[model samples]
Target: MKASYSEFVELGGQRYHVRRWGNPQAPTLFMLHGWMDISATFQFVVDALAREWNIIAPDWPGFGLSAWSPGGYSLLQYTTDLDRLLDHYSPHAAVPIVAHSMGANISNIYISARPQRVSHFVNIEGYAPVPEFFEGSLGQVVGRWLDHIAKPGQGRPYADYARLCERLQQSNKRLPPERAKFLASQLGVMGDDGLVHIAADPLTRFFAPISLHREQLIELWRGMSLPVLCIRGGRSFISKAFEHRQEDLQERIAALPQGREALLEDGTHNLHHEHPEQVAQLIEALLEQ
Candidate 1:
């Protein structure tokens, strides 16, 4: 594995953990992990890159080693965090970004609002949840959010790191033992209670009260002028969710002025982890283009 280091910086009045890899003098690449994921999740992809890059990945607040937000998390807060992060790291120039899942969604919104801050975007399986998932009245949505917050739940604890590693492999069969071991070490932390808990804040598991406005998001996508390469894993659950709505997915991509899509047949939602080399190749190709 290539060497990497960690840095903590203040963003939105909270300490954020940032991971760096490769040469600092090389062209910079910003990587954003998905929901409940940490900056270290990009290790494999970083290792697979054919050329040197100054990679910057941050663990979003409430996940990994970053300070957790007292009031839980919101999309607006995340975008604000990203805005501050970019200002602190690359204030003078727009930089290329590779973001997965939630990170990609955030980047989509961020780029739309501030197109000058991003030169290119490689979106990995980051689409709004299908409409069916949001079928309900506004009050019902807020009620569900209220119910969750009223009875705050805790994450399941593991007996040890070995058990956590087993759980990780069970969730994703394609995850090899060695890589799973590494992820278990990074994603799980031993608690004082003599059990291991996921490094993320437990409140993140709750549903947000705000309803997803698909049309609004599409409008945002439409406004983006930078190049975007959307990569989807053929076997990912997200693909299954949109199987009947493939056209809707295509239409969303079409909304972008310069957007294209690619499908990786054997990959899953965590395709970057399962096939880092292929993911890296796609990213490098986009950069070359």
Candidate 2:
């Protein structure tokens, strides 16, 4: 795969590894993966969609093969960088945006706030405001205190590459052994401690003090006029405390100015990876709209 891939490109002094698949004349679809995930997350879907749209996927800094920023990395920085990439590449406009998890959040902000730069959007299992999701339940809060007393950020890392593979397989119960193996391989790196540490930066695993306000995201949605296809996993949280009800969201989505939605029958937070066939169908439908 790397043999067929283009070399990493440097932009703004940081290297970003990007890969494009499919026809040059076709419409472009920019894929964004969730936090801690690499561009490999879209390998299967990108291959399938490549025959139609030019699919471009880049590894977010600090997560995949891309170079991380000097200090802590933040989503705001990603949005600014994304805007530059869009200005440079999608200047002609009408670029379709497809994203999952944190990627979904970034794309949502970009398209909603700057519709002139984007054509359409497909968000899968995007995060929404929860009064308690970030705050935590009283019981969970107590549990956290207990956890802190026991050990602070001391969970054991993977024992070995094989163990890492096993852990990924177990967590992603929907994945086949081969698929899990492929994903696990991308995230494993030799660490100084002689272990295959997961590619995720530990600093990013915890919540940062700064983030866009929930109300602000809602405002973006309200002002958004571009076509939107918001798909949520039926099993996913509408809030950290509530699951999205598909039958209910159908009407709610229809009521939104220019939005439509579907609930994936077999999907998780990583809906695109977990249910690529359904997600691809949604993307095709959105493109037609």
Candidate 3:
């Protein structure tokens, strides 16, 4: 694994943990992990990169080592955090971003709102529109949110890191034993009860009260003129989301002025973890382009 360090900074009054790797003089790349993931999730990808790069990935508030928000997480809060993070790290120049899943969704919204702050985007399996079934009326959504919050969920605990590593492997069969071990160490924190719990806050499991405005989101995507490389894992459930709606998926890709798609036939949703070398290659290719 490449050498890395952690830095703590305050954003929106919350203490955020940022994981940084490579040389400070190298070209910078801001990495964003998916939901329930941490900054260290990008370690494999960082290790596979052929060239030098300064990689900055943060554990979003309420995840990993970052401070939890008593008010819960929201898309607006994430975008605001990204805005503040950009100001702190790259105040004068736009930088490339490589994001996965929820992180990619957040980047899509942020780049659309502040296009000048992002030079390029590498979106990995995160552009799928919200399924129709997930949509609900305002009152219904709020009621569900209220019900969920009334009895907040908690992350399950494991007896030890070995047990946690086994669970990780079960989730991703392609994950190597060594990699799984490393991830278990970073993703599971020891609790006062002497059990290992997921580093993310349990509040993250609750549903948000707001409904997604798909057309409005598409319009936001349309406004982004920067180069975007949308990657998908052929064997992933995310790809299954568009199995019968390829045209709708293509339409979303078409929304971007400079968007294009790439498929890794044997990869899964966690493509960065499963195929880090290929993922790094694709990112570097886009950067060089």
- Over the stretch 88-166, how does candidate 1's per-residue lDDT look in tens digits? 9999999999999889878877887888999889999888755566558878877877776676677899999999999
Sort by TM-score, best first: 1, 3, 2
Give RMSD (Å) of candidate 1 vs. truth: 1.4
Q: What is the lDDT of residue 152 in candidate 1?
A: 61
Output the lDDT of residue 159, model 2.
68
Candidate 1: segments with Cα more than 4 A from true spot: none
Candidate 2 stretches with Cα past 4 Å from truth are: 1-4, 136-156, 244-255
Sorted on lDDT, highest at the top, how do the candidates line up?
Answer: 3, 1, 2
Give the distance in Å from residue 218's predicted Cα in candidate 2 to where it truly belongs.
2.2
Per-residue lDDT of candidate 3, residues 1-289 (tens digit):
8999999999668799999999988999999998888999899999989999989999888899999887877777799999999899999999999999888988888998899999999999886455554557778777877876777777689999999999999999999999999999999999999999999888887637563466876798789899999999999887777788788777888888988999999999999889999999999999997
Locate the minimum summed-lDDT window of 10 residues in model 3.
127-136
Inter-residue clash pairs, candidate 3:
none
What TM-score does prediction 1 earn? 0.96
RMSD of each: 1.4, 4.4, 1.5
CA lDDT, candidate 2, residue 214 = 58
Is 1 or 2 the stronger prediction by lDDT? 1
